[model samples]
Target: MRGPAEAEAEDFVAAHTAIARPALVPEIPLHLATEITPIWQATEAWLGEQGIEPPFWAFAWPGSQALARWVLDDPSRVAGRRVLDFAAGGGLAAIACARAGAAVVEAAEIDPLAHAATRLNARLNGVAVAEAPGDVVGAPCRWDTVLAGDVCYEAPMTNHILPWLRGLAAAGARVILADPGRAYVPRGGLAEVARFRVPVTRELEDRDERVVVLSRLLG
Candidate 1:
């Protein structure tokens, strides 16, 4: 589950290209990959630099980097496709899609702040992005693929996203969700495609590294 600190960091992102820290700050932040840069803080700083904060959700918890690992392993899934990053937070999955050669990518998030953060992070990572307001699932969209990461940590989001995802699938959109065994993960026909052991923190306890990956329904 994503923690409060992470949410706060996202809430504080800037809209300019560079940001100055106003205080020492008190949130324990985690970095992406084997780097020392805290992803949450970096995202906030990036947003601060940009100088814009859009409306966003309180806790669109992104699971432990599961989506990143998969994109690095097999980058072609996004190549030359129009992709949607549903409920995108910090735009990690969207960044992965951009890196994978997606023709066009959009970060569809509900929160104005999170949407701001997502755009900031995407730009920092040199990823191009388009923004779709509110929960983008039921809205009219044109996408070849849809990706979700760590959006199932709550019952409400699950209830809303699940049926919408299934509906997208039924409409011939290639959809994939990345999770690390989150509590609300549904028991359906989802088949694990890959897994990883990601380091977690105190707020996310009982984790012996997160097993992360994309899933497919196996009949």
Candidate 2:
């Protein structure tokens, strides 16, 4: 059952974005903003008028694109395992996990709009991704594998979540993070697994292509 907030989110997304395939991960389609500046401005206006945060859910960041592509190319990493996609913006990695045959998949995001977009995108990909709302950082880990993409972009956010992610790794849960040369990604404690040259919108990333790396946390 969908709540009123979720329904409102869906409606707002439908109004503001379009269903299209991202270049790096073209296998799955997502509802994304076609013009970054227009969407950002609109989101800002909405935030001032109606108290909505900027819709990060409408763009497929380079890290997420690489992560999703890697997962799809190598299903064995998540197949038959319970998977959690932390801070699952737009749920691209979660959908990849499901499509790759994960036994169970959950996408955790703090924004209601992201939750709604994730559900909608999962449905578009013909998969089921359970939405775990609210902040799940520092929460007990139950999933066999956890995926994080583009989470180190902000200094404060990186500082707050890295330790919790390290805790998950220390506890023996496989923690994989994808980063596109973010300023805050640590210089150590990671084992490089894969890399991708992801195509991205310049309006969002300021470059046409980004080199994204998928790394496993050293436990």
Candidate 3:
């Protein structure tokens, strides 16, 4: 049985977003916001909570798009491996990993709305993505691969999560961070693996496209 809050969250997600495919990875269907401003404003009003972050899970960002594309193109990278999609907004990369045959796929998020959105998106794609609610930072690494996409946007968040991510790399997990030239991306300890030109809307970004870089986070 679902609690009232959980059911309301899912209802909000289904009501505010439409089922659509991201530009870079079109094979996987997701619940995405059609109009940016309306959804953003609506989320704030609906939540009725002050200082809530924008609904990042409503859209598939460039970093996740690139990560999903990369993994789907080469399933062998995650097939039969335990995978973690860190900060998994809408679980795009996580769904890709499941589709690519990962033995287990976990999607981690701190936002309860994001958790609901991920659940809806995963079901829409006909795949299983275990939810790792709340912060998974500083937790012991149990995954073979950790996919982090678009996670370096804010300095405080970057500072808080980067060291733990590095520790996971040191623990022998293949930590892949997909960055779309965010302001706070570290200048060192990243080995480039793949690059993608992802389409975006000017309403959300300064330009119509973002060049996403998939890199191995060096321990």
Candidate 4:
């Protein structure tokens, strides 16, 4: 166990954008929450399941749950807009956007399990989520809105990802983040639109979290 171990994105994860089931279907036989957990290719985001291993960065984070609540609370934020959910785990944010009335919605992840689970969760909820691959960092794409939850937990990801998020905003996409105060959240203008207390497993650390919804400030 030394140097960085890695797998080709295709071998471990799907390279193409995928579509998943909705979240409210109540029985996700295809997508088990445990199966979506991330391997310890990175850090300590793992869920401590008995048979399940650690390094669970791929599973859905608490902030994603917070965003889902926000959507359920107020669907107008995404009403009739095209939305992109970055770092989509279990496709929560993207599903929320669809539930909120977005005409087109996508959930993206680089991890294979996470990406696949995103699609499954979409089916679970009876919502549609188009899954996309590749790192969205510094990517030049256009969308009406971008929704991110719990993506800023790691320093490297935040450093690379936040700038791209800003770029999306610069392209006029309304970027929103549901952050529960991880160490790596980048600083920028954020107008609070909503907040929530979400339940999180002890394995991920931090219980009774506060989910903050920020409105991206225009420059």
Candidate 5:
């Protein structure tokens, strides 16, 4: 059974966001913040009490958008495979994988609110996406394909997770990484797979669009 806090968190997410489709991947609907400032302020205030991460869940980032587009364009990439959406914010890619007929789809995140948003979005899409709560960086390779989007933004975080991601690749998992020109993305060790031009909110990206590069992480 879900606790009161969990229910409250879900309520907060539903109350603060609107159901919208990502610009690039419009087939899947997500709970997205209509405006940036209000959600940021609300998240900051909520963070003071809950000590949770920022509201990355309130937007469909470029990397995730690209991943979703790629998977939807080619369902065979995920169909019949067990897939993982790592660091899934609003679970766009996970939903795409599920829609593409993956045998199983799991969305992993450390933020409780992100989990809530993912659950809401998955339900809205009428897809079954299992939740892998908390940090799953060091977990064994339980999936055939792992999708990581926009995760290399911070230096420390990139450093911490990259090795584990590579290990998963070495262990025979097809680890896919989508990057939107983030500063910390590794220059090497990534074979280009596909690219996408994703529309973005100027309030968040300071631009009209971002070109996301999808790559296969080399072990």
Candidate 6:
């Protein structure tokens, strides 16, 4: 049975977005906003009226696209392993991990709307991804593999998350970070494992295509 928060999120997402496939990972379809500004305004209006945070989960980011493609192309990376998709907006990487045969998959997102989106996307892809809300950073690493997408966009978030991710890597958990050349992505510690030319909307990325890289943290 769905909880109240989940039901409310589902209703909000259904009212604001449309089901569409990301350009880079066309195999998986997701519910996404077609117009960026309108959705942002809508979410902002909702925030003013109902005190809800802006819905960043209603978009498929380039890093996630690259990560999802990499996972599908090389399923052995996550196959039969317990996986955690950190900051799992839209649950793209989580769904990919599940499809790649991960023994267990969990998506961690702080936003209730994102949790709803993850649940909906997992169901759409015919996979199971347990949605965990709230900050999971610095927690004891339980998964065999951890996947993070576009997490370095903000300096504060980068500072808070990178160390925890590196700790997990050091502890022998495979830590894969998909980054779109964000300013905060560390110059060292991460080695580029794969790269992809991800097509993205100009409104979101300010460019037609972004070269996203899948980097593995050196333990």
Candidate 2 residue 190 C-alpha distance from true site, Å: 0.6
The sequence of per-residue lDDT tens digits that candidate 1 reaches over residues 53-127 is 322222223342566556646778778999888877656667777878889988886656656566556655677
| Backbone collisions counted per model | 22, 0, 0, 16, 0, 0
Report the lDDT tens digits of candidate 4 across residue range 55-150.
233445667666766666778878888888887766777777887788889877775556655655565578887766686666676578888887
User: Native-vs-model 2 lDDT?
Assistant: 0.88
| Candidate 3 residue pairs in backbone clash | none
lDDT of 5 by residue, 1-219 (tens): 668987888888999999998999988889999887788789778767644456898999999999999999999999999999999998999999999999999999988889889988998999999998679999999999999999999999999999999999999999999999999999999999999999998888878999999999999
1-219 in candidate 6: lDDT tens per residue?
998877877888778889999988899999899877777778777555554555679999998888899999989989999999998888999999999999999999988778888888888899999976578998888999998999998899999988899999999898989989889999898788999999888878778999998889877
Q: State the lDDT at 175 in candidate 2.
A: 96
lDDT score for candidate 3 against the true structure: 0.94
**In candidate 5, which residue ranges exceed 4 Å CA deviation?**
50-52
lDDT of 3 at 22: 94
lDDT of 6: 0.88
Residues 25-53 of candidate 3 have per-residue lDDT tens digits of 99999999977788888988997876678
In Å, residue 18's CA in model 2 sits off its true spot by 0.7
Q: Please give the lDDT score at residue 37 for candidate 1.
A: 33
Candidate 1 CA-lDDT value:
0.61
What ordering of candidates by lDDT runs from best to worst?
3, 5, 2, 6, 4, 1
Pull out the clashing pairs in model 5.
none
CA shift of 74, model 5, Å: 0.8
**Model 2, 1-219: lDDT tens per residue?**
888877877887778889999898898999999876777677667555554555789988888888899999989989999999998989999999999999999999997778888988998899999987579998988889999999998999999999999999999899999999989998899999999999887678778889998999876
Predicted model with the maximum lDDT: 3
The whole-model lDDT of each prediction reads: 0.61, 0.88, 0.94, 0.62, 0.93, 0.88
My TM-score estimates for the predictions, one after another, are 0.70, 0.95, 0.97, 0.72, 0.96, 0.95
List ranges where model 2 is wrong by over 4 Å: 45-53
